[model samples]
Target: MPNSEFSGCRWAVVLLVMAAASPSWAAPIEQSDTPLPADCDGLKKLSLPLEDAPPASMASSLKGCSSEDLYFGIGVPKDPVRARQCAYVERQDPDNGWPNLFAGTGMLMTIYANGIGAPRNFDIAMKFACELGGAPAEEEGWLAHLQKLKNENWQGQDFSPCDDITSGAAMGFCEAHGAKLASAARKAKLADITAHWPSAERKAFAALEKAKNTYAAAVADNEVDMSGTARGALSIAAREAEDEQFLATLEKVISGNLPSVSPPDLAETDNKLNALYSKIQKKKDTSDWGTVTKAGIKKTERTWLIYRDAFVSFAKRNFPSVAPESLKRVLTEDRIKSLENFGN
Candidate 1:
């Protein structure tokens, strides 16, 4: 058999075992309450101010400029003639006017920090940072920029110092401002995705419902031995329904076959199943069917852990190697300093 097919079968077995063993009440562990990092306080105080405007004529010429322009403008090649042409175009099209100077300035600061146009030049970096610190309109732009950073495809990037620095800076700035911003953004995105989830959820529910019906029929016919696969399939279907995105995509595939079920209803069903699994596992009788189910669930959990570890190992292996000294200074030294200065 093909390797891919073998892997798929292996994963199915793993999932089946985990689902059987998992306690109905097995919820994700919550994080412990740790004190906020000390350097976090100082980093919070670091604000970017906007620098003075360009010459009146130059500013006019940049009228129709955009965030993209601002991104390219700072330290980008300047052609007075082309800029004049752009200004003329801006005069003709008011709706597509150039990006606000402050927004552009913020964008420039981001670009510099990200090392987009140049190598890691801390001098220019400090300049733009100081500019952002001074700019009044920079707050909104900076916040929006940070959101963009959060949404960045980090896994796809080459992962250079330039890119990573901007990411770290964006994260630090967001944290300094308030970690709530990141949390709120994540929640908002999740909400948006969940809002349109009815169809996907309905489809998942139908699949589970079908599985349940099938199992019930098997039991009625006294075919208990043949019901294991159906029960396993039901567990998988129910779990898939709980995954907002997966359900949404699956809904498309089984469009007309979906039942009229909401996400909340599906969620409740999942919770009930989890609780049932937990109850079964707690039973003392080792020779009972509940024990067999619990064992299968344990196997599933182990398989999931193995799968997770494999991906993590793959990521670690593929990650680009950076200079040890650079890593130590950037990741460790700066963090240590930030912590040391936090309360002071």
Candidate 2:
């Protein structure tokens, strides 16, 4: 992969919505040119440091509880109040690193702008937006946009922070928020499903989880075309889909629902896969494969081969009655489908 794509993935891996509150409506506040207070009185009004401000603790704590998940109803009920409180606490803390600060500020902007927990307050939203400090022109764009909405008496429920995203970086930030929510939900589900397994099974499950995650990462990095502006978001979506599929497959495995295969079937699938790969290799010179080069395809295939072997080894220990060739057949068939796309 190119260095730019790698950097984009790093930006995505490291980075990590709204509703109405009351039935009664209030007229939008008039836009003001008033200079924002140095201390940001809006934040102070919340009486933040809602608890003792532990140095460098808010980010990890918020992630653990998944403030976004709660607010957006990803895996749990929507609780904008809880989400607002969590983000507000972090927003007040000056000791946080830049990334966390940016994240907290963005969350608060969404909450206030949408009237999710508190009353819709575009002034407060603009306050948070000003702190975002993107490029000067971008910052001006945000302020102007928010100011127009406020002046026009726009309803908070009608707008979202993401609706105005124009740049790739900003779109990436928005998409990453969603990916985090999905990941949090996925983690909660896997934990619930495996909570009562025997110790040895649990150990094997952990190994399986690690292997799948590694393979998922490889697919995101190597399989997806990263030449577009949406590459970061695209990669994130692909990785999340891979994880969901892995979880679904695991559930099916535990239920013994995967089709059993004979040794001859395995041999046939292996031969088909080898022939398809060679055909794909031949098409590399003439076909439009987008961002995925022939070399990248080979690397991804190698990674999948390793993952298949690891999975088969795990299945041998845990399911001794299951034939090894059956496992190989299933994985090889899936790989064949993916490789066939290259030829198409």
Model 2 misplaced regions, further than 4 Å: 1-102, 126-160, 283-287, 319-327
The candidate 1 region of ten consecutive residues with least summed lDDT is 4-13
What is the model-wide C-alpha lDDT for candidate 1?
0.32
Q: How well is each residue in 49-95 modelled by candidate 1, as lDDT tens digits?
A: 22222345665556656433333342235333343334233323424
Residue-wise lDDT of candidate 2 within 48-101, one digit each (tens)?
A: 222322335555666445445566776688887777766655555544333231
**With candidate 1 superimposed using the best TM-score fit, by how many Å does residue 16's alpha carbon deviate from the native?**
50
Residue 199 error, candidate 1, Å: 19
Clashes of 1: 27
Error of 1 at 184 (Å): 18
